[model samples]
Target: MILIGQYDSPFVRRVAIALRLYGFNFQHRPWSTFGDAELIAAYNPLRRVPTLVLDNGETLIESAMILDYLDELAGPEKALIAARGPQRRQCLKSCALATGLADKAVSLLYERVLRKDHPSQIWVERCEAQIGAVLDALEKERAAIASPFWFGTRIGHADVAVACALRFTGEAHAGVFDDVRHPALADHASRCEAMQVFREFVQPLIPPKG
Candidate 1:
């Protein structure tokens, strides 16, 4: 198995963290979507990061799909997500919120960097509001949970997703994630990031291009 993409990407980082936790031995290619678009396109025409090449010459695109396949490979007991019922729904919801927040952060970053001269304040405000809303919702959910992870004692998909998203949000948009404003999420992210798996696959945010 091979994992492609820079760890700076929250999507790619999540997948990489999961692979380590699952004990999969694979190659890591820190390819940038901007600098290595053509190379990535050979495997994923969309040229997206977090593209996983399976052992048997098959390729997987998108972080979610790659994670689904990995969970299947790990089987029911070791799967990161709950196998059924309300547990699965709750986990998915949190993951959705976290990933959505990450998307908005990325979009806002592009707006400022790519359109520096005429960035739309209205659009930027909308993205900031979305980011804040998601953070509030996640912080509330996290605060109500007593477990070290989102799902009881064991870490799960939601934990990884939220942690990765929070890291990216903070790195890409400084001062956006205030520890005082969102203490629960701040603590949650801190714990997850302290893990060896996370530390092993870490990368600094890529500077924005003009």
Candidate 2:
């Protein structure tokens, strides 16, 4: 499998980390969607990062879809998510929240960096407020988890999602996740960073200039 796009994106990075965790053989093509539009367009109409191209010439776009495929490949027991019940829904819900946070961070970034005019200051404030709310919710959510993983005692996709989302959030926004307001989340961030896989995925990105 060939994974396209850069790890600076939480969406892409989560899929990459999951592939590594699953011990799946894949190649990374660090193409930038912004600068390498034609290259990304050749493979994915979405022109999105983390597009997975299978060896058989099949393509998967969007991180969640790619992740579901990966989990299926891993089978029920080894799958990164629970296959049934409310537990599965909760786990997916957590992943969605984290993903939403990452999405907002990216939006905030693009607005600040790529646009000729600044976004509505109210919208910016709303986005930041929502990001903080998500972080706090994640902290409480993580605390409830029985293990280091997001749901249950097993290491699963939720853990990967949260870890990747937080990494992108911190770097993309340049220190907006203040530690004082989110001690548990700060601790959670530490645990994610302590993992070699997470560390391997995180380097540095071009900080969004405001």
Candidate 3:
């Protein structure tokens, strides 16, 4: 199996960290959708990073889809998410929100970094507001997470999602994350960053660009 993308991408980092946690052995190819457009397009025409090539040479695109597929591979007993229930729905919802936050962050950064013409300040303000709102919501959610993991007693997709999102935001805008604004979120992110799998696989890197 092969995982393509640099860890600089929070989306790619999430997949890598999950692969590590799941104890899956895969070859890591640090491909970028920017300079390596052709390489990424070979597996994902959308030219997105973090494309996973299964052992049989099947390619998986989209972080969410890749994660669900990987979760299924965990077998019934070791599934990352609860098999069924309202709790499961709530957990999935939180994960969605977290990933959405990360997506917005990436959009904002690209707007600032990629475009030759400056992106609209109004749009940037709107996205930043959304980021703040989501972080606040996550703070409340974290307070309710009694266990070390996000969803429940076991580590799950929800935890992976939240951790990756926070990791991205924190790295992109240093000192933006703190106990004052998001105590629970700060604590949760700190704990996750200290994990062996996370520390080894998910830290921000020297971002490879075109």
Candidate 4:
């Protein structure tokens, strides 16, 4: 398998981390959507990161889709997400919120960097507010969970998703997002990052080439 995209992207990073956790061996392209648009377009016309090319010549686009495929590959017992019931719903809900937060952070970054000369203050403010709201909600949810991982002793999709999002938001908007303000989430991210999988797959943030 070939994993295309820079780890700076939370979406890509989460997928990469999950692949490692699942014990999959694949090549890392580390391609940038901006710097390697044509290359990525060859596989994904959307030119999005986190595009996974399987050995059988199948390609997967979008982190969620790739993750779902991975969970299926891992089978019921070892899948990061719960297979069904209320547990699955809660896990999916957390993953949704975390990824949504990441999407907003990425948008804010593009708006600020790509349109620096004429960025919309309204959009920036809205994104900032949404980031804050998501952080608050996630922090509370995490605080209530006394287990080592969000779902239990074993780490799951929600844990990875939230950790990746928090890492990106903290770095991309360091001035606005203070770890001290979201202690529970901060701690959760810290624990995740300390793991070898996260440390090995990590990359520093790089603004898109405009």
Model 2 residue pairs with clashes: none
lDDT of 2 at 52: 94
lDDT of each: 0.95, 0.83, 0.82, 0.93
Q: Clashing pairs in model 3?
A: none
Clashes of each: 0, 0, 0, 0
- Model 3 agreement with the true structure over 1-210: per-residue lDDT tens digits: 899998878889889988887888999998877878898898999999789999999999989889888888976577777778987798789988999889888877777666527778988888888888899888988887688878656777778788888888877756655668898887888888888888787545443342
Report the backbone clash tally of model 4. 0
**Candidate that would win on lDDT:** 1
Screening candidate 4 with a backbone cut-off below 3 angstroms (N, C-alpha, C), the clashing residue pairs are: none
TM-score, cand. 3: 0.93
Clashes of 2: 0
- Estimate the overall C-alpha local distance difference test score of candidate 3: 0.82
Provide TM-scores for the models. Answer: 0.98, 0.93, 0.93, 0.98
CA deviation > 4 Å runs, candidate 2: 207-210
Instruction: Give the alpha carbon lDDT tens digit for every residue of 1-210 in model 1.
Output: 999999999999999999999989999988999899999999999999889999898999999999999999999999999899999999999999999999999999999999999999999999999999999999999999999999999999999999999999999999999999999999999999999999998899976698
